[model samples]
Target chain A: MGLIGGSYAKALRRLGVKKIIGVDTDGKVLRQAQEQAVIDEALCGAGPGLQAADVVICSVYPASTLDFVKSAVPFLKSDVLITDATGIKGSLPEDVQRLLTGRMEFIAGHPMAGRQGSGLGMSQAEIFDGANYIVVPAAFNSSGAIEWLSSFAGAIGCGQVVQVDAVEHDRIIAYTSNLPHALAVALINSASYNENTKYFIAGSFRDGTRVADINPYLWSDLFLANRENVLQELAAFSQQLERWREALTVADAQALQEMMREAAVKRKDLY
Target chain B: MGLIGGSYAKALRRLGVKKIIGVDTDGKVLRQAQEQAVIDEALCGAGPGLQAADVVICSVYPASTLDFVKSAVPFLKSDVLITDATGIKGSLPEDVQRLLTGRMEFIAGHPMAGRQGSGLGMSQAEIFDGANYIVVPAAFNSSGAIEWLSSFAGAIGCGQVVQVDAVEHDRIIAYTSNLPHALAVALINSASYNENTKYFIAGSFRDGTRVADINPYLWSDLFLANRENVLQELAAFSQQLERWREALTVADAQALQEMMREAAVKRKDLY
Candidate 1:
């Protein structure tokens, strides 16, 4: 019904959306979602059973996004504005746009925030507080749908609304999200030693690699689906690494100091 | 004084080693350190300017550690066990052992604990709480000096005293400290955007590259002095980055997934 789909079902219903239904393949999660009174109805399949709602928001793994969209295409209201809450976008937006083919307005949305811990239990109406809601528009998008999506993003308490194409969104996220995650994974990999050696590590090590502890299954899907852009960013990163190596290899203290100085100054400017 | 000379001064005075004197070049810092009453007396110069003591500890940057030791060799108490508090060992130990030849015992010491903040303001008697202190001995080192250094590390609350050679200490630190710092700098340098872009950056960006906000003067010296070992580790990291790039290039979902899985498992093992 709204951004996270299930958790805000009651709130959306109170706000007078006609009917609320939660569709999840996992029976346990579906029952738990309903038992929480977050949704008025629950269903297992994404077929005609989900057709009555004025809008539909899908939140699932990036790898299965297209498959889910294809399955739900026929059942949606003909004029329904379909949206998604996936991390990456390239394949899903293209596939969904083709499958629906102007029958419904397909708008892509991503809430640019989440915590270390996430799931149905951790879901909240306030989760989008002060967050930015990114609106990604595909080729078949209507400007009216964009305005409504922006309003939805605002109603959910998103502090900012950004507009970008799916391709551009994926590319920028490759630097902002994927690259940082990969770096964290690499840093933590080097610290897997015997217990004694690990005990000597400090808060800096713990804080530096905390992202490595995220759920692996979701991350693997996100990484592979965003592979092209992630790789491009990694190539840029490798060249940056080489510059550091060159500065270190020749014992060029001044050059190394300058680079580090610039980095420190730029970083402090973020304050 | 303690493991790194100043801690030894604080501990020895508490142990009734009367008239403790500190030696350092920074007059302002030394004056501040003295005002804190961590040391009974403070000398902001080389050893010839100070009165004789029961023991002398040299705590200086790694590159100048040997020079400081050589300067102190001629003026220490005849039986004084001269030790150091430098991070790396390979070249510094050799230089000290060569210079002090037979006149005094040169036992290299490293206190593995440190505060995120540096200098006298952050110094404390409990600075080495539950920390590992390594006592490195070269071929010509005296056994009595090693025993004395171990006791010194213990006096400063170094939880464990590990005995090692200079080469081993440097090798391990190449991976643990220097390489990690280089990686942080490289990651920070990968982007050239200004403060606006960084403002939208969440915890992941800050956490991944926080170490880039280090003292450039000190780090430049460290990277230059440990050039060879840092280069070797950088090469290894570059190879890993290349492997990740290859996985992305062919859209090899399985390879990328396996890489993430292996890294995740390895990282999880550290906890």
Candidate 2:
């Protein structure tokens, strides 16, 4: 459990969620959350407290998410709906829904919100304010469940609720999220920085590579899990980059300015 | 004159400079600056008003810096010291110094400060408060003159003042400013963003691509003027991006994680 888990607890609480049960392997963090009133019942793992949970929000690193759910399944109520805060859906929606198979409901969600810092210490409910919540629905999920999840997201401070299929979710995320991370990481790594590097730093370099200081463990999994889409976006980005290279190579001032203008328009409109 | 020119006027005013002579071909803008107290004197192109100046800070687009200096030469006092706020040094220092040839002092300074928005409306002295001011010195420059320019930058609210030659200045800026702008423009161009793009937008994408809303006229000149160094940095960045692409292609999670960790460390250290 990290920033996402702690944030979900806070946001859910704001939605008047009663008897918030926090589950984490780290008993120390769980105890701290309980003391801070982030959650009412802090569980070391899945316990009898989960039996009363109408909704199970599984927030973990992508790699550990499936295992956590499988272990908790026996303790969850049969009517409980499980929603995940995974960055990339990949096959999580399908695999988890298949495993549940009418035993419970699973609707995967990716809250398009985060900060540079990670861990529960950095978490806050306000990160979700004006953020988009992507609902990745499996075939097994009822429309009613999806509708309820959308409203749940809105109630928890999300501004937009978008329901996309797992494939579309992964594809969209690969472009908007993963590709930007890859670029940020690559851009930062490309620098041959000495102590003098900081003296030359400005807004462009600072903001452009801010995401390079990432949770390596989580992001690497996100990159690999959505490999196909990430690779495609990377290729597209490379081609666009090559256009800049070609223009600079020939010192084509007019062509360079035109390309930059188009990009400026796109960026302004998109953002 | 654009953001850099207006900002220099503002900063020099903050330093208690009694007279801020604003120069521009745009007569209306000059008059507006005078009216708004941004300038003590508004000179249309080169005027007799420039004869009383001790120092001239030439803040124009990189492409026009040389021409502006040439036109202003006759009007400027022979003992006057001149500096520029061009993002790229290129041959500006050498060319300007050679042209002046003891007629006036020429010291090039690139205050590594900017915003996404351009023009006089967005100019502020606070932009330089913690910004790096890179002094690009030519072979003919006096040690005392360089030292004074460093202090001048400090007086104008800039933080660190780094003295580097024209070649080194161009090289460092290619890495820091030009490369990041190239990545931002390329990243924005890579996306086929529809109206739905706004819904998917998050901090990482937003911040990373913020500079994509560039001043095409200014940045294209910066990129082309510093073409060789910019191209070199772009190649290095492409190679770094290729590493991410390769790790994803094979679905190598551990390799990806290691690369990301290295990037995270570098980013943390450099920033």
Candidate 3:
């Protein structure tokens, strides 16, 4: 398991779940999980380990998440409920709806919490503490299924459980999650960086670009999967940047002060 | 005295300086700082209080820094070593040099450290712990003065003391400091923000936009003071942002991942 999956496994273990069957391509992580008691068993990929699972939490990249569901559907109990911790929900709800058979159900979710690093070593049961969990309920999903997923999120320490449609979820995520990552990447890759930059980096530079140290494969897939919304949010943000450029170019002190004041008020209000 | 000035006062007190004199327009803050023993004495303005000082630290906005130095120049202590905590060094070195009386020295410095909020209420001596201290040496400054300022920064808990000229300081800070603050303000004021968006602010959004809760009066002047360099860095940042937009539009996952990987490497290298 990776960061998200391993964390779910760890948090579930802390909850004293009857059994946690961890799966990962890395044999060492699985073995470590078993030895550390974070999991009772370990599997290399989706297999019979999922057969006894009443509820499966798919914590993988968007495409791999769908792939895992398709592979595990055959082995899972007919009435098992499934939810995901994918970064993007674009096209997932419809794809899952078409792939499902019998009584299987899939709810899409996005956890609004993450650390800079990845892998099981960075995983923590408390990562979800005071985090926002966005649950995307599709047309076929029942209230009962949604409630189960919501309560599960709450038990795992998510402070806010927000319900929104898949489209809205992607849109909000493009602004809140994906846009920030994209900007962080762009900032870290900017041409202004030079040899002496290391000595100049402070909290603003450090915090603003912390997510630039991202897992490329996962983020590449997520960004492409939700390309349009990301571009749209980028355009909105570009417009905002242009406001700053214009204000600076003209040396309009009053305009600059007013804009900064508005942003300060908005930022303070967000909390 | 605001956050920076008050913090220096607190830090100097922690260092057991013989006397700590604070000045501010806000009478309430002056009284609070005096009663808290953070400053041994408080003055409403740069009047007689600066007459006895061996070193004067002007922690005000860029323009106000010049004004304060000019106003305090008329006071005694002709041998005073003046340094500032201004965000931008554009035009400051020459301006201070032109304003200096006989035997006075001004060494422009920036503390590559800050926290959210301002005012003496938020001041802390340990804020500079392990922070980088940038000392911008003007033509008029002597090596002895720079050494004294560097050691003072060390005594206040800066981990790294770097030296750069005023113009270079502005250029580097445009990237390290100004660009980040501008980006943060723009992100917070983006059009996508709606009433429900508050539920989505997580570590990425929160950390990325943390500086948006800034001091408008201070930042607006700083941004304009370093307008050319700030604009140049913004252009560089915009170009990088356009790379993301183009890659996403063309569905170029390979390019996207490659750029992200490079950013990850660069970000990791910064440490």
Candidate 4:
């Protein structure tokens, strides 16, 4: 089981979800989750139990999420509600909804909770505590499905459950999540790779670059999936940096101080 | 009483220093430090007590540090050891050494410790605990003076006392300290200034941009004083970020992953 899936299973189990079934390609991971009581049953693929379930939550990579949903469509019960925990939604929700038609409902969800480390061993139910959960509801989705997902999120200890359209979700996430990760990676790479340089790193450098220690495969997929938004945000950040660079180059103390002061005041308001 | 000076006084008091005479322009701040037992005596300006002191540590702004040191030159005893806690060296150490040639010794020091908040109210002796203490030894400095400073650093609870030349110290700090602060400010300003955007900021965003809430006047002086080094580091960082932008633009998943993975591995080593 992956970190997000395992965490979901643990949270669901704590909420007394009856007979939770985990699906994973890796048998060893599935067995580990079962042994840890994160899941009651482990299935390599969709089975008869899938058709009997009232709700199915798919936690998979963004690249494979659409395919996973498509494959699971035939095995779902007529009244079953389906949701996904993918980072980038794009048009996947619309595509999945089109495929399901009148058979099932699909609401796209993203749990803005993660650890630098991954895998079943790193999963904890408390990871969701004080975290933000976003639910992207398409025009075709029913209000009842949205309400149910909101209640589920609250029960799992999510501090906030924000409802927004898929387009807005991707746009905001590009700024709040993807852009920061990109900056962290860039900051880390910018440093000269030497033991001497490592010795001098202090608290700010460590905290500022923490996200650089990322799951590359997962992040790359997420970045490419939301390519347009990420690029736009990246360009905006670069332009912001360029303004500071200009001030520094010209030795404009007043301009530099004003910019830093404004940022400081704004940042203080956020916290 | 400023944060760094007040913290040093607090730590020195705990170490049973016989007396710590604090010189400040503001009488209220000096009184506050005196009332807090952070200093044994507080003066509005240079007094007879300053000349009587065996050692003096100038904790003032970089622009004012040289002037402060110069003003104290006449009051100091021939054997008195002089040092400063200035953010930027920028030939200040050389100038001060030249001014006090054969009369006193000036060793530049930087305490790698700070809080987002300022003033004596936020000062704690424990701020120095497990923090780095860098001593920039000048060519004119004696081994005995360096040894004395090292012991002083250890007594104040500095986890490590690193010895380096002034040039090396400034060069490394440009990358380790100044660049991170610059990036943080730029990152904070990069976000669209809106209430909705503020609400979406999470842990990584908060941590990555914490230093953006900076003392602008202090930072501006530091940046300008170390303009050449800061600009060089900033340029290097921009080049590094540009490489990532290129990789992302072409959708080079493998290259992106490799960059992230390398940064992650290197960052892991630091902790």
DockQ of each: 0.32, 0.77, 0.88, 0.68
As a whole number from 0 to 100, the lDDT of residue A25 in candidate 3 is 80
Of 1 and 2, which scores higher on DockQ?
2
Cα lDDT, model 4, residue A182: 84
Candidates 2 and 3, the one with greater TM-score? 3
In the order shown, the candidates' Cα RMSDs to the true structure are 5.4, 1.7, 1.3, 2.1
TM-score of chain A of each: 0.85, 0.96, 0.97, 0.95
Q: Which whole-number lDDT from 0 to 100 does residue A12 have in model 4?
A: 90
Q: Model 1 chain A — which ten-residue stretch has the worst lDDT?
A: A191-200
Q: In model 2, what are the clashing residue pairs, if there are any? A: none
| TM-score leader | 3
Q: How large is the interface RMSD of each prediction?
A: 2.8, 1.3, 0.8, 1.4
Instruction: Kindly list the per-residue Cα lDDT of model 1 for residues B1-271, writing each as its tens digit.
Output: 2224556566565666667777777777677667877676667666664437666677766677667766776776666667777767776776776776445667887777554335666556575767778888888777888898888778767777888787867766666667666666666777634444552455667676777767677678877767788787777766667767786777676776666666666556656
Report the TM-score of candidate 4, chain B only.
0.95
lDDT of 2: 0.84
Residues A1-271 of candidate 3 have per-residue lDDT tens digits of 7888888988898888998888778899888888888889888987887888888888877788768778877888888888888878877887976787888888778678778778888899888998999889999898989999899999988999999998888888999989989888888889988777999889999988998998988889989989999999999999999998899999999988888898889888888
lDDT tens digits, residue span B36-76, model 2 = 89999888887788998999888888778788888888888
Q: lDDT of model 3 at residue A113?
A: 77
List the lowest-lDDT window of 10 residues for candidate 1 chain B: B192-201
Put down candidate 4 lDDT per residue, A1-271, tens digits, no spaces.
6888889989998889888889999999988888878888888876665776788888888777778777777888888899988878899998888878455899888778887867888888888887888889999889999998988889998877888899988998888888888888888788554666655666778777888888898988998888888888888888887887888899999988998888888888875
Tens digits of per-residue lDDT for model 4 on B84-135? 8876786887888888845588878877888776777888888889888888
